[model samples]
Target: MTTPFSSLEDYIALPRVESLALSPDGRKAVLTVATLSTDRTSFDRALWEIEADGEGVPRRLTRSAKGESGAAFTGSGDVLFVSGRADASAAEAPDAPQLWLLPSRGGEARCLTRLAGGVSSIAATALDGETVVISADLLPSSRSIEEDAAARKRRTDASITAVFHESYPVRYWDHDLGPGVPHLLALETPGGDELPEVRDSVETGRSADESRGVYPSHLTSPRDLTPTPRRSADTAGQALTPDGRTLIASLRVAEKRSGRFVLVAIDVASGERTSLFDEPGVHVESPVISRDGRRLAFLRAPFHTADAPADQEIWVADIDGGDARRIATDWDRWPSSLVFDRDGTNIIATADHDGRGPIFRLPLDGSAPEQLTTDDFAYTHVAVDASSGDLVALRSSWTRPPHPVRVRADGEVFLLATPAGAPAPLGSITEVATTADDGARVRGWLLLPDGASAETPAPLLLWIHGGPLNSWNAWSWRWNPQLALAKGYAVLLPDPALSTGYGLDFIARGWNAWGAAPYTDLLAITDEAVRRDDIDEDRTAAMGGSFGGYMANWVAGHTDRFRAIVSHASLWALDQFIGTTDNSEFWQTVFTPRGLTENSPHHFVRDIVTPLLVVHGDRDYRVPVGESLRLWSELAEHHADDDGTTPHRFLLFPDENHWVLKPQHAVVWYETVFAFLDQHVHDRAWSRPAQLG
Candidate 1:
């Protein structure tokens, strides 16, 4: 049978690839496709290869059941990609989807490392046609989704907040020493070890089940890997050496909020390691050695402090270790996804310093970086031909979908192909700046209802994004402002105080000051939106999930400005959440040390006035269903008051987790939301059926 959804547009719109990597020769480009299942079927993902100059239709190179895409070309013509599948018996098992190999020129795909485990990270450089330097992961295994789904719902023997954590870490490759791989070496360092398996919970003295976080460890060469544990070195950055000798990595031993890291160089064969320069004051990010492999260029920034902006500087250090100097000091910039031109003369990196990421070129000798594009979009992803240095970058704006573009050295830009299905021209989209109660001017991008006029008030939806820290940009996508705009509602997203992109301080302000500034900004935005002559104040509604859900909950309790509210996967009870959710680290760092207090949401439940339709996944592990249940249960008790009576409803998607990943669930979701919003915000009247018509 055909799917219930009518058009592919509704079922799915955009191609699921968010990132891409080009082969050194730039003859082929790899597409990293992350797919969302149609139902609770199998989560499928694959890597598709396309010709660099728009000469080939994208062809799927691999069929993967558990999502395999980080595909890239080696110095040799051979291709290396992260290929794996879910352990049919476990969820994120360390023993599932071991590393595999494939030819760049298409041949048999073989399992390279049968360590019988999943690899979180992989780096490959061709020494010959058959050899490549690689890093794979080995972690403690857990039950698979299917296996866990097979079990009956069991009550927990103990109480816990954060649940269902999978702590998988990447380990460097040395012992297996894939045959003939050049620089096939291991560096001496610390950290990156598998945690002890927890057979069962010993609840009394021990708490609930939890995954162990990564620790500082010594990276001893295979010869010394046994345990004369030297100084610690930990890094999540790709563990690769260009010249194939000195392995450069960052150590995560320091206690800093910025996740401060230390960069150290290790001699793979000798197991001897030395700190390039201990960046104790802050953190150092991914370091890229020049193509010639003589110098290391990495981004450095101060540690994250409560009230400070993490200033970042791009610094280049000699491989032999000395004369480390800062080259780039734009606080607004950082090294984006990096790709060096195969010749190694110029380093290519993407930057979105001003909301739109354009490409920038940094010389190997640490000269000034030249901006490559004028129109903002993400220039961070580029496919530069190793042979000619001809660059192909993906660009998009709020109004534009990302499409690959070709840039010639002469400075001319050529469009490769329109994004798979570009949206029809937007009738009218304008940025609106509105002032809040505290005189804070919030900015928002407003998409107008096609047939509506300023004289005629339009139905409006004030959509709030969950990461309250995340900012709303001009991007056409699913479940975003586009969905509501197409449904005929003017969608408005306010760039409230705590939103990102403004600076680090603005983001940090969002921590413990949740309902304080954010709530205030939301109310001011709503009131300002209502004041506009083109809006229908009485027909307005609100919707958001996670942090957005918290806003909806708080708005309902404090104001009657909104007719209806939609809360999805939200944290409603801060008091209970600190002690109940798995986000205690965030709570401790961002919120308060004292935990939940008497001023929590449950204690202030009397403030709610607007009706709410609470939606959440039954299997959500992040913010458990317990939070939703508590909010809904409590809101139900106060459904009516002296002022007026409002209806409240609850809907749960079973088997779905924090993210509603299935297409079927999305269809059901949109329909339910439309029907609910119409019932409340439209203020329509209907007669009941009488006398059995």
Candidate 2:
């Protein structure tokens, strides 16, 4: 039997559980699972229900061709989700994702809102179930939902796609920021019968648009909660008080070439806004309201500078913005998420710790945080059962994909029944460590194939993680190492300087000096791994994407130890990347003129002797395609022969962004990567994939 890890088709077809949402009553939990679509070109997400106690068989809740996501429970136990599924009775299909409700009593899901720009995300659902807050895009010229819809309709009819931006960043990651500004809207319950009717004849199905409402049954008119918002409302982290009276949100305050997020409170009924915390050079995010509606807990992080990195400090304050204090002052790890406990006495947080993301319990009394889980797995989407005080989350490690799990207050974890069973093991994983020249500790996770020893050694693939600020502590669908292990390669995921989970001092070691400490750390760790008997040092390769991709380019020019190098969405020229990337402001501060001259990989193209593979997505905005274009041009100018033939190959994804996300594209990505490595590292004949043609 061919395992999922061995066959890319089977791997893409495997069901993936991405998120978990627990009911407040603690009776059931809902999971969002993505499966391969019928065409095999996309993944369709649907909702599944499983018992919170880990006893009942998993049951499918909602299915649609367009898919559903962002599942959250209303106060009345209704499942609120966002979907782009079209309505059969409607005259036209929905152009964007709309809010839908799957009743607690079990019935077909129904559309609730039909704004032209559609819903961005569900901010919060009031505990009383009478009001729900959501974020939606509104044209700056429009004041109400109807006006915004009309404005969008006119733009569509005229085929106008221009956006007038008064902001620093007009684009992010892969897409343009907006012709519309994001605003928080509240939907008050009376079943939508009393709302004013819309007057767009072309929009409503009825002949007399003046006398007809825009939507059919279950239509709820939205009241603007944050009006006159620029670009600040889109990325706000919001939480609603249990009584549905106040909304706590982190709104971005635009600055010169940069921005800072400040926590704010809004009166849901009166639409009044008040600032909670607005300190300079700091960001407040991840607001969580206590169950009793008396307090708020959020993460405060100072902006990073060229000289040093910053830490995320967990802070708590009263609902009225009084009695503020920082908790777990002694904790060194940076928390990625936080949620208040059932009784609001402690905060259940998750942070990266020594190559694993574990749940921690931080008490309100300013005491030390308690480590809850000791396993080598990472947890996400953690939710507390207010009725039972138990916690449920989605957990996974390098050896496994994400699956729903029930965690007790005492840190006991139980695997819940899921439709997606575990795939065959790819290989075994261990640890590798070494000391850098500066006497700093560097470590990484190593995946080794089975039956590898001194007699039959496996080729080592040194995999560098992106983020330069991120850690390889969790499972990644995009940068999975399991596939490499299944192909008889030992994969090494190293966390050099600037990786999180380690103390701030560790990250500072590479501050504005990417090529110095971070570079040496990779070499030191690779040396330690290659020294082992089970690894073949002579057949080693290096590969990375994003920052990792940048490092791969650096390694190719800096050393000849690796047989091959694969750089994906990498930064080739620091001077060019610093100005062209999505956020030029932050990069400008980090890259001094001297640093750019010393660290740029393009400056050392003549030193590269090993075969190289360069992969990039045209839509990538973080590290623009220009970097690779310049690198390719430089490679050809310096190394290409008379026939213009070179060992280096460039794989470009026209439709992909920073990552190749489409199902078909992802398969091709892996196929091309495997072929390149085989040709160079394994000394196999160069065989091009037919799909590339």
Candidate 3:
């Protein structure tokens, strides 16, 4: 049933919908209709609307917002979005991202905001359509559009060589040289006089110097939005006032420790701010509000984020900022994803306190919370239509791939992702059990290739996600599991030790242990996959990005299980990475009892034996490109030893950063990766490194 192709470019693309949102009336579904770039490895997000019944070829609403996301329809049907609203370069000045207004029926998008500095997120209210609250790169107090992030880091005496990527994610990256210090500077009066600390607006100051070494690469040398020690972090989406008069979200402000966070409510009309929730020495994440707008929910942990709260409990607050409280009196595991019902009678969120993801609901009037869906795997996402209160969620297991289903409160089910006779229904998803090297039962998902059996073992790809702190849920999306599976290779995302929701001890166990037991979980999963009749162990390949990229690099150095490997925005050199990453202090010291400078990939590059493919973004300040070159150079030097070491190739994208957002570059990168796999895994051939246009 698969398309037989001579090269990766001819492969059939994976069909999927992402970021699904419902129209106010619940008659239409608005989602991003995404397809693999013709280049065969990248993806593009276009606005698409489909019937609520999950029928028809979705109507494309807008094609112009290339990198835009988080789309929604106002109560009146006008389209709203958060996108590349401005040139990040203009961030220091008072400009806005290009906020556009698109007609619900269809047409060219109209600009709403000049959108100068980066506008990261936006949302409309259920009560009134025209009102919106957004989060953006506040104007930095500085002015210097000519220096690179590296230069800025250099100017600040930060280690420039190991910083990953060029520009760190605006909110994700903080100015940090070490504990008790911030690498970014606020526009201050230098000298005996202290500059008044301005916390309400983004801060920036102009400097013509191009030598502020090791700043973010994605951002051109320009002004930066100095984080208010109180409003430094933000939420994925905003919740509106019952009357659409305000928007509530979580923001990260500066802290004396490694990471600090604050959740606030902003009046849409007056721009007045209400500090709803604040925790010093703790991190706040994913703040969401209920339908009545009287209650708010979010996740909180330690500032440096090494440990969870005494419990990562779900907390709620009065919209007026009078009385705030905790919803779950006892939370054993971390909580994820929050959503409120149409009438504000119930609050829904995903958590793994039960060992696996089980959707649960808490009553607003103080009723006990109840688990909604019971599954063996994890639920990565949740969707609720406020108009009708219809709910949909995705749950995946180790052996089974992710399946999206419309679920009812009474336990009824209707499959959503499956179309009648759609190539391969998600039904075949399966799981297997493996024991980590330490003998703990670890679960894994298995998706076999089409038209495959024991006699036809297919190539396998060990795909790992970043955020050793993040969990890989069983869900379907365009970027992973789906993309690789469509390309004829089996993909694996094992929930390793450092992974969240397994309880604090399990999560903290992997700390500083770096290349130790956490690796055992991944390898154990691979060992089980190889034991399957349909897997081609000899033709295996491994790939990952960010912290996962660190694992990929570490795996290659520790063993040669795969034929080829790709490391994206990787932290390859521990020492350099600790000193260079935008989160140097956190990753270096806070992430573990020991520091990352002592726990990096550079320590074992000399022992690497696999044929490697190194990929990085010049703008990635999170996991800098230098890590790639360090490993690549070591491989090159090994070959020059007359030792005839295995060959290595490097792929660098100049204008991109941590995540590949550009259409053409994504295609090229995807194609290269698949071609690399085809040579060593499926096609069973090798060739000189050829650049793809």
Candidate 4:
């Protein structure tokens, strides 16, 4: 029997469930499932509903060509989501994503907002589900939706694609910041009943019935909550109190050259704002309100300097920002996301620990964080059931993509039946670790092929993780080692120096010296992996993306042990990267100029002997295409033969961003990478991908 794991085409076609949303009543849950579209060029997402108690099979809730995402349940159990699907009732359907509602009493979904720029995201829903807050893009100078639309049309008519910037970061990871800034807007919904006529001419700026179809008479106008926002609400983390009277959010406060996020509470009705937790050199984000809306649990991270990196501390405080104190102070792991437990006495959070992301229960009394659900999987989108106190989250690992699961209060985890299903088991994963020369511990996950054994050793692929700060703890669709395992290669996913799962000290070891400890740590872990009986040390290659790509470049110059090296969206030259990257100000402040030059891989390019493959997307504003272009140019300048040829390759995706997102592009990315590895490591002929031709 052939499994999807053995074939790239089959693997890409498998249905994937990525996020989970639980109803307030805890009777049902909704999941966001991604499946390959009929065209196979893109993945379309849809919402699915399942029994929260695990009693019934999952049922499809909503479907459309454009698909639905950002699924959240209103207090009344009505599902609210963002979709760009056209509405038959409207004269002209929205082309951009708009807020939609799926009534709890069972009816067809309805369009809720038709902003010209579309709804950025659904922020929060009131307890009764009447008041809803959404994030939308508005022109900084526009006073109303009509004016914003007019301004946008004017730009389109003039064919002006340029963005005027007054801020430090003009672009984000993959796109320009904009002619418009994100603002929080609050609106009122009628739940299962009909909405009232829209008021406030400035809010809607038109006859509601003419613009909005069907329920125009029932829907109220969306009120601008952050009227004078200056990009402060861009990608802000917000939570609405159970009473829906106030909204707690993390707004970016722009500094001279950098910015720090501070917590703020906004009165939903009056649009009044209050500073909650503001501290210099520190960021307060990921705010979560208690079930009773009495307390707040959020993450506090101080800015890192060139000398040292700071830890992210979990802080608990009163709803009004009084008597705030940090909890889990002694814990070494850094939490990524958190939520208040049903009882409000403990905070349920997920953090990278050792080599896995596990859920931890941090008591308010501050004894220690209790580890829950001992497993090899990482969890996200965790929601606590107020009635049963059970947890529902999306969990995944190397063996599986994200799937919905229910976690009991006592720590038992049960897989919920998902319509998306699971992929075929491909490889066995084991933990690998080694001690650095400095006596510090380094660890990673090693994925082994099915036939890997002492008698039948497998070639090794030493894959590095991107976030110099990230650990290889969760399942990654973009860089799945399971595909490599299926291709009969043993993959070494190392969490070297600067990885999060380890203590702050481990990160500080590589603080300003990126090429030193991190590079050596990768080598140490690789050395340990290649020593295993089922690994062939002679046939090995190194590959990474982003920061990992930088390390790949570093490894290529520092050692010829790996037969081939692949770097994607990498930093070949440190100084060039720091200045060109979107968040230059932050990087400039974090690393000294001397440190950037000393650790730069470009300086040592003349020493690289291994075959190199550089992959980058032109739209990658984070790393930028210039990094790869310079690396390629330098490789040619120093290593190219007189015939104008070299043992190197560059794969560029003009439409892609920091990552190769489109399905076809992703396939080509893997094909090119695999071909490069086979050509150099296995001594096979280079095969050009047909798609490129």
Determine which window of 10 residues in candidate 3 has minimal summed lDDT: 183-192
lDDT of 3 by residue, 1-693 (tens): 443122234323544455666666666666665666555555666666666655565566765425457776565667776555332332332233444456665554644433223345553445444455444433233233222222343434754334332223333442322111121211111112222222222333321221232333322222222233223433434567656666665555644434456667766545467777677766565666666667666666654444432456666666665676667665456777887777766678788642367777877667777877776666655777555577765555443444455667765556564321123332144666687766566665566656556887777888776887766664533144545666667766666777776676667657667677777788888898888878778878888888788889889888877888888878876777666666666654455545454467777777887777888887777777677778778778765457654567678888777876565565577777776777766655665345553
Distance from true location, Cα of 293 in model 4, Å: 1.1
Candidate 2 lands at a TM-score of 0.96
| Shift of residue 261 alpha carbon in model 1, Å | 3.6
My TM-score estimates for the predictions, one after another, are: 0.74, 0.96, 0.74, 0.96
Q: lDDT for every model?
A: 0.57, 0.87, 0.59, 0.87
RMSD of each: 10.4, 2.3, 10.3, 2.7
The superposed Cα distance between candidate 3 and the true structure at residue 174, in angstroms, equals 14
> Which segments of model 2 are wrong by more than 4 Å?
92-94, 189-204, 207-218
1-693 per-residue lDDT for model 1 (tens digits): 122122333446345555566775677777666555555333456776777787757777777556675665555545556666542222223334544445664665544332222333454343222323344322112122122212211212233222232221111211221111111223221111222333422443211221221111111112221121111223535345654455676655525222356777766555477777665666776777765666777777675433433555777767766878776444445455565665666667775443445677767565677877666455536766766778877666666666666777654677663225455544357667766665556676666666657677788898887766566654634355555656568877776766765555555445556667777777677777677777777789998887788777777777777888998888888766655554344454545543244225565677777778888887776677788999877876766555654477677887777767665566556666766788778875422223112
Per-residue lDDT of model 2, residues 577-619, tens digit only: 9788889988877767887788889989999999889999999
Residue 194, model 1, lDDT: 26
Count backbone clashes in candidate 2: 0
Candidate 4 TM-score, true structure as reference: 0.96
